[model samples]
Target chain A: MAFASSRSRPDPAAAPDGPAYLPSSVRNMVKLVVAGGLGVGKTTLIRSVSETRSLHTEEVMTAPSSRVDSLAFTPRKTHTTVTMDFGRLTLGESGETVLYLFGTPGQARFRQAWLDTAYGARGALVLMDLRRPEVSYEAMDLVEESGMPYAVAVNDFPGSPVLDAATVRADLDLHPETPLLFCNALERESSIDALIGLVSHSLDVYRRNTGP
Target chain B: MSRRRDPVRITPAYLATGGRTSARRALPDVLTRLVRVDGRAAASLSPPQHHLLTAVDGGDLTLADAAGHLRLPVSAVRILAGDLLDLGLIQAVEPAELPDVELLENVLDGLRKLKKPA
Candidate 1:
């Protein structure tokens, strides 16, 4: 994956010393990030919600022997997301408004970028594959570590066991308020609705916790 | 229009002063001008750039370092860096020296050898 860089230096005529200001009217945009493990259908979820061009951010997956056991499985898996994946969406029909959706790399080795992506995010949608529910823990640790509230989207893979929400909650040991729902990521409506549910739930939680 | 030249008039006292005061006074003025001009253009973050920017806002990585660390191709990172540079979200520091291609080739060659059945 190519990391996008600026080909030319900043124009001297336009160079500013500080952050450019957006009008206050445009400042209310919302950002929602979709984070999950590799092959967990994060890309599919974003594409389903917003077909707009998504930024393909790829990071080298390095095997960190100090953390996870890199040699346990295939020797071929090299280079992980040192960065993050990104996509964009517009909530409702107002084209003027926008939602920035970022897909964080799931491996524990890429925790630096994952934590970075979670910064300033109101919440996150942690996608889980029911077949390997154990994998959900790493993603959960990231959200919890970052102190960002999150909702879980269980991607129901075909032929995978369909566990009830109660069982999933128990297996994952989720707090009562955390939103957990099943989704067929391959289906557009299902994936999009899953995101909508997450965002709405997160907003409610934020409002209640912060008051107003 | 006829040109009129003023007679050269430099006193010993003026020469001794060495024009240092005037040059020193202009330094701050020039610096302030540069800051004001650069500040306005630095604020807006493009969507994808914003994601990348937010990822690095913690100051853990420099722009090029972030790009290399991310394993994104240099060109793509260059493009994103340009956007970030323009918005003043990030500043370009010196580029890291390229790693030794020969060393990398040797390492890969060794890995290839390891994969072969003994």
Candidate 2:
């Protein structure tokens, strides 16, 4: 629910002279999902790392289009509009790659939007709040079911309980290979580290799948 | 006319797409970066189609971005963009395969640099 009101200055990378179009050298465009439960810091993390302000895009879908599990919760509504937040990061020395970070809306009724954002994504970074770990379960499950590799970051809020890492991992039922880290979503460096963890883990997963 | 029904200000998706739900060729996902190939807008093109082209005129914008600019659903943009693709008026630069090791490495390197203080 919090916006980046504290950071009033513009990003240096996105200065007035920056190129609006993708550099001709750019050949790759990757999509990464930033997901979590309601009130989690998906948007905050994206705001911290993205060169541009996070954008909200709306999708209108029929109620029946959602999976049965979601349908059961919203049977009365025939049509709905869901909005998702996204940010863009152009990386590498020559800007040969761009990463699109999509923050999924927090609600079971928006599963269709989640799937749309997850489609063709390389990996996902799932944020959790240790104070209410159970709220993140659905996001983690959706990420896993999409068959893409993912990393989990515990977004630290002030005064949040410091639970044992192993106990939290076991409660989440995370895989042995999944990368788990702690991050403060409001900090640009911390958010970037969480993204680094995800991309690194994704690289490992991709290598294992394709063989030496 | 039932008091004109609040004046139909927004263009319906069915009309914008000419009632076509799917394209003949496979459409790119919402995240796909699309660029305009032809700057000359066809006189026959609908307003929504024109808005889409203007959205991606010089810059590379994603299908979702175009939809947001056009005030239409992503589904409608997909169909409209497919029409443009079929006409060879635009190009889609599909993202590299997710499993491409080199691409992942490039992204990792970028994040590392970003982690450093600016």
Candidate 3:
């Protein structure tokens, strides 16, 4: 009950897999995160797979927070975000199940917002930069800590050295059961596969958790 | 008058009320929608509140989308939406209970379909 406060953390049972129910009045709306380090194809993956141009919502950073939160800023930038990049993906011919991709602002200040966005989400597609493995650690760490199920997709950026999954997984120290994938975030099919990999892993976790 | 603009100013929506933080105790999830918006929805609403009612009139939009389109913060949207909900011009889409078996099944089946070669 300690975590039940509305301003505080959301109940995991409420979701991270899918909404508890789909209202007949609304199409089945699902939110999934495309998250990772800055420029790890998080936005690109969403754009590549999204049915529409992504939308964004932002929150102004408090004066002190602007100085501290975003390391990417050059002292002039001011907005922290409540991210909502509404990218709709139709799942089947009937168009019954629609997935909404929410692109996360991959900075630490936006960490809580990232976790909040993951509510009602099936899972997070955590992209990793093979060349800059260190950049992904913070993003992965938050996802891990949030108890949000995720699949790590190593972006097959041009000029990135070819490496095997096992070696990289070991280097990242990721839980073995967590799915790891290699995807070129540029291609629509490849990006979609990375998302499918995450959904598949989340389904397994749900079955494991919700099963007897 | 010396002209100066801080890149980010406190929004008129928030300023017209009090402040943003404590005004929205009744608000639930940030993605919560205003299910109905009619004439009664316009009563006693500040400009931001009116804008929220107008934004979600016919569309199924989350509080975040409203805030994005309106250039308001999530907190501000929550406050304004609360006023509209109280006016009976809007209603929150009821959330379902957890551990939903059928919903999980649908999502799993959907993902499997997406995985198939196309």
Q: Would you list the clashing residue pairs of candidate 3?
A: none
Per-residue lDDT over A28-117 for candidate 2, one digit per residue giving the tens place of the 0 to 100 score: 888899988877899989888776666665666654343445556667865666778877788877877888898885466677668867
Docking class of 1: incorrect
TM-score for chain A in each prediction: 0.74, 0.85, 0.77
TM-score of 1: 0.54
Q: Rate residue A199 of model 3 by lDDT.
A: 73
For model 1, residues A83-112, the per-residue Cα lDDT tens digits are 455544433322333355677655665675
Which wins on DockQ, candidate 1 or candidate 2?
2
> Could you tell me how far off, in angstroms, the CA of residue B37 lies in candidate 2 after the best superposition?
2.0
Arrange candidates by lDDT, descending.
2, 3, 1
Please count the clashing residue pairs in each candidate, in the order shown: 31, 0, 0
Q: DockQ for all models, in order?
A: 0.03, 0.43, 0.24
lDDT at B13, model 3:
41
TM-score of chain B of each: 0.36, 0.74, 0.70
Which has the higher DockQ value, candidate number 1 or candidate number 3?
3
TM-score, predicted candidate 3 vs. hidden true structure? 0.77
What is the DockQ score, from 0 to 1, of model 3? 0.24
Query: TM-score for the first chain of model 2?
Result: 0.85
Top-lDDT structure, candidate number:
2
